[model samples]
Target: MKSCREATRLMSESQERRLQLREQASLKLHLAMCAPCRNFGKQLSILRGISKSYAEGGPERTED
Candidate 1:
């Protein structure tokens, strides 16, 4: 089993590049058992989406 630190690193690296099959398996297994890591992964995805939206000019704001 991978430690939380290792699992988090793999999750981050996966954003930049494709992980090996073994790495993918390990990360999947870790996430299955670790709630915190799973939440972190979800947050990472949300942040990435927000960043992409911002890069694309984001949503329009109206004066209230």
Candidate 2:
């Protein structure tokens, strides 16, 4: 089984490049059994989306 460190590394690297089939399978298996890692992955995706939106000038902020 892949360790949390390895799984997190894979998840992060996935953001920069495509993972191999074996890597994907291993990550999937690890995520399925690890709640914290799965949550971290979800949060990572959310942060990536937010970053991309800001980079793209997705919205303007207004002061309340």
Q: Over the stretch 1-64, how does candidate 1's per-residue lDDT look in tens digits? A: 9999999999999999999999999999999999999999999999999999999999998999
lDDT of 2: 0.97
- For model 1, what is the error of residue 7's alpha carbon versus the real structure, in angstroms, after optimal superposition? 0.6
Task: List per-prediction Cα lDDT, in the order shown.
Answer: 0.97, 0.97
State the lDDT of candidate 2 residue by residue for 1-64, as single tens digits. Answer: 8999999999999999999999999999999999999999999999999999989997888999
Measure candidate 1: CA RMSD: 1.2
TM-scores of the models, in the order given: 0.91, 0.89
Candidate 2: list runs displaced more than 4 Å.
61-64
RMSD of each: 1.2, 1.9
Query: Which regions of candidate 1 fall more than 4 Å away from where they truly are?
Result: 62-64
Model 2 scores a TM of: 0.89
Error of 1 at 15 (Å): 0.7
Clashing pairs in 2: none
